[model samples]
Target: MMTSAKREAAPANGRRLILFGAFDRHNFGDLLLARCAAAGARTDIVFTGLAARDLRKFGGFHTLALADAIAAFGSEDADFVHVGGELLTTTAWEAAVMLQSPSDTARIVALHDRSPDARTAWARSVLGTTRRIPYIVAQDDLPTRWRTHFRAVGGVAFDTLPGAERNEILRALRTATTLSVRDRTTFDALRHAGVDTDLLPDPAAATPALFGATIGQRGQGGEIAALRSRMRSWAAVQLAAEWGDDATLDRVAGSLLATSAASGTGIVLYRAGLAPWHDDLDTLRRLADRLGAQRPVAILESAHVLDIFALLAEACAYVGTSLHGWIVAHAFKVPARCLVRGPADKAARYTDTWCDVPRQWRTPEDGPLFPETISG
Candidate 1:
């Protein structure tokens, strides 16, 4: 039995939190940080610059316009506001420059999760966006090659943030020393930036997907078998020269639908949304006939980091081309088999975390873990 007086005092431990990013979906890291930060404080999530339906369910939150993300902090003085900005792109579009903290203000910035495809056709444009934010609150990291780009984004000659290393800083913030990242590229970048970035794995299998045991001890059923079966078929299809065409995706979906019907379980599908290009929700609708219901698969369009992770966690395994999907899936210990081209940033992180699960990067049949590492 607790007394009213003691219960009344319970509110003293939690801190009022203000999170950035679009929380339209479940993100493992995002949810973890927000939950940890609000341990004792009554947090107020300022969904600034975002219009996500996923976040609507979060009560006692005030969704501010993008224009208000910065100003929302001091104007609403609840507690400290962490700088949750997207590191890969410096554009002020996702940063809070207008809400610059006082000279001594302590801010936390989220770093990159994508690899440095230095050949990325979008570098110069990203640099231009950095000029808008003008300065960095806390420079989180990504892969090594991407650092130069981050420096360039801020339009500076590269004067790094002081004492912001990963192990030390995350501890100092009273938070985990690890920050969620999407891939090895981002991990390498954070290592370079002196930040310890953790890879957010792709969605886990809805069923038990234990991979720590020996070949005979490994649990193989449900989604796991489905994955193995698909790989065999997909491999031959690839050898025949049909990979990314719409027909292949449908063939894969058919397998999943048949499995769902046999199991009498509700089927759920998801998209990584990491790449802004092909995450059209309409694609899911197109496959409605072959799905259990209209929501058979959800091609997540826009979601905050936490929302995305949560959504992915529900799926048994992730079979997608999105890099983030692979990261979040594996991070949650979910089986995420990628259909990517080759040694990609996301593939690196997945391979590093759980070598037992074959990454099969573009390789037809599943073999031992892909040993190829990311390098210069």
Candidate 2:
């Protein structure tokens, strides 16, 4: 490990680095990405939609204005710019926002997502405007769509390794300045693609300070404190509306009630989605009302992500239709089991280590043995 003097001296003479990402939301997972970015930034301004009330949970930002930073871009003073660890499938507003004002001398760097399908067409278009790109978390044997996109964008080289099997992917890695990957799938893929693999964990996992702070704040007694403190073995439940299966929701509710009843602990249900698809609240409300007569259930209708996370921290275990709920529980070291209804790939990709249900936890003949699995 480097000495304190070396660490302190590292950024003393380097140019200011401007970091950017889709941090303008109330999602805890997104905040985890922002926290990772914050941990590395020497001096930075964050452009996030996170309310001032919740921004305090992740400290160390120089400026926390959403509008000014989004509007002005950068001050043309930084040496390099980096956007880390977010799926860029939507419109390229952020890339447009950041590149709008660029320092004449800044070298742009990016942390690429692991999946080939994660980046969208608009993202490729916006990133294409940059000079030769330097990639982070760069994968070998990228899907043709991404490979074509990178080639069109005048891509220079990759710095990080991810696995690939396609000769094209291996050929691409041969040009990377440095290389590493985080998953065995990627490792074998890259080895097949003919590139050396050095496994590393996802960048977001490296920053525990923010996650710790979130738990610390939750520990402080307040509006939810009474409920949080009263609950010791409650399990967290969350689901999305896009699934559109009322029967499934009912089953989940019944499972939660059974869990609560059997374990002798309250049940905390979270409405974890945001607008256009913020179906969790209404769905959870209906389920809570139905389960209330049978068992004590606490329905969290809060729109703030931290409040939900704080509540999750109090749970003994978590079972959820929302992937992030399981992730948050796992982050807190609480046992988590995912209730997957739709695509199993995403769940399989991320939750290989967690207890997971390839399908809904409950089936026609099943009482959803989830309570026993979760409480156990």
Candidate 3:
């Protein structure tokens, strides 16, 4: 269990320890980082700051530059300073740049581990620098080269993959300051490597409650009832059009239509991610046309992330291509069928760790894993 920092003495200067992260955007995944930091902090000296480039149109959180963040760390300050969330792998330089800031005073904690996307040249450059980072409390799905590189950084909690790089990662994790992983694969890998590792639930498991609380805070809890009242049994359908073409989406829509007909369930089409590179608004429109009034489908192109989750909570089951969509559905114990778009998709990786049933569908016709007729 993670313990709270009990500082012997208060800081000489009365400044709250700043909780830093790459929350420059409105991504709920990053928001989870800030929420976890808030949950862990003890003193009122808690300020949330974004270390990444601010892409959000508008937000109330404080933005911290490298210099400003360093100033917040008092030499004798208890382990109050935390660098939490998924910033470690989203943008290559996020972890490197955030940790590069000069400060030995604060204890920096990296909350979730997503190995850097090291396939790119820029990612490789950043991975080279990430070795300088001391410790990270990470998730299990790190890439091979990234894991091999992370070996030197030591303190990490990850799952082991079967590959040539296994030996190197084992050696690195063996010297780690702490080793805890979210999956049995990681635990077995570490044990086989002659290292001890503890199994823990992934951070994504905890976000539904946090997401729900965020919804209540925004005064949208009432809206869930209003939305739920519109449908008999809403099954949220989320797909990433960026990964596959229009044909792929048509297949998913067709599958959903069939399922709706079979189960008399209503359909709610929504987008979980808001990155400009991967918008599903147009895709949802195409899907609606495909459904063509056979079943009533509501389009939520502009729903808040928590609003989407709220709808999912009230959902009969969730069927989607978004990894977070599946994670959120499972977290809420809402029946879910995660559509794995690609073989190496993160959603598939995560499903392997958590769900015992065959929850992943490669083809739309493979059907919802937890059909309403069969689900409890």
Candidate 4:
């Protein structure tokens, strides 16, 4: 675990720690990061996100809007911790769009798409920031008395951003009281930019150690209970909406069909996030349709974060495009493989940085799904 002397001193000074990240949405990794940060903090903590959202139904915190949370602290001493995630490359427009309800996302996206001025106006209206990278707040955005800390955050594609945006992110990191990155790719990029940072594993790697029992208990009830009762043995499968095209789905379905035939285990498909660009029920349904009832393939429609954890925890193996799915599965010592677009993909970069085991990455063009090592 990564500990800081600043965090240790905060309790003595009675400074409340405002834990901030992408927790306002339903992404499994972001929600898990919030829980892990809260569980590990020594002082009182408040959860803040891009928007004020109550996600308790999904096993997440009642998150406050970034601006509101900062204002509430006023001149009081506090520690602002950017909890964790691939937060660096997210633009203002992307963040704002993800926070909107699925129904409102299409109209908002269309409006933003039509005009650059409209995009800026809508992003500013929703996020309360004009900065291109709104998620990583600079010192000017906070109270003068508050301190900043960033813990094990990932930004694998930081090098691909424009110079001005890169400088913006650098300015934010330079002001942090303590800064650490989750992947070597991000660390090397920042280092080349003249900013030094500690390299650490993603915070979610500690999920099994911190919340193993709680997660297991959560599985004993609700939708997870029903799933557990139904599948005697299964492999947890998940993919983002970006891979939902017919051709990609056919490739994935073919690989999965062969795996099911060989192992005689059922397939359980789950959504890792409900944000606009994350997972899609329709996409998962499409993949399921291609599977065509060859075996007991089931779609887990639950959005609860721990339920997602429980499903992965109880699986015979995990195969997906989600980094967190691989992280959680690896945490529980479950055999797993992560699907990636290429070597530069975030999941691929992360595994390259920290995974000691040989990686078996299945891309869209790959024929076989799981390697011989990942078996039921």
For residues 1-376, write the lDDT of model 2, one tens digit per residue: 1111101112223444333343443344544545554564555434333112234433323333333433454433332222333231222333332332233112222333333343333345545422112122132322211111111011111213232213334444454333444334444444554555454444444333456676567557554676656565577777666544677666666667767778777777776544333344667777677686676567765646557667767677777655566666666767666665433234333454223443333323444636354552
Deviating ranges (above 4 Å) for candidate 1: 1-16, 24-41, 44-47, 50-61, 65-72, 75-86, 90-184, 193-247, 254-267, 270-278, 288-317, 321-334, 338-341, 345-376
Tens digit per residue, CA lDDT, model 3, 47-66: 43324344333222445543
TM of each candidate vs. truth: 0.43, 0.60, 0.63, 0.94
- Whichever of 1 and 3 has more TM-score, that candidate is 3
Q: What's the residue-level lDDT of 352 in candidate 3?
A: 72
TM-score, model 4 to reference: 0.94
Top-down TM-score ranking = 4, 3, 2, 1
List per-candidate RMSD values in Å: 14.7, 10.9, 9.9, 2.9
Q: Which is better, 1 or 3, measured by lDDT?
A: 3
Better of 2 and 3 by TM-score: 3
Cα displacement (Å) at residue 366, model 2: 9.1
**Model 2: clashing residue pairs?**
24-49, 141-169, 161-180, 163-186, 164-189, 164-190
TM-score of 3: 0.63
- What tens digits encode model 1's per-residue C-alpha lDDT throughout 1-376? 1111111012123333344333222333233333333334444444432332334343113445433444444443232223221333333323332122222112312132143233122332432322322222222321111111111011111123233223333232222222344344554555555554444432232112331222123214434344334332111011011233466556655655554444333444443332222243445545444454522333333334333444444445555554445544555555555655455434444555545655434433233221122111
Whole-model lDDT, candidate 2? 0.46
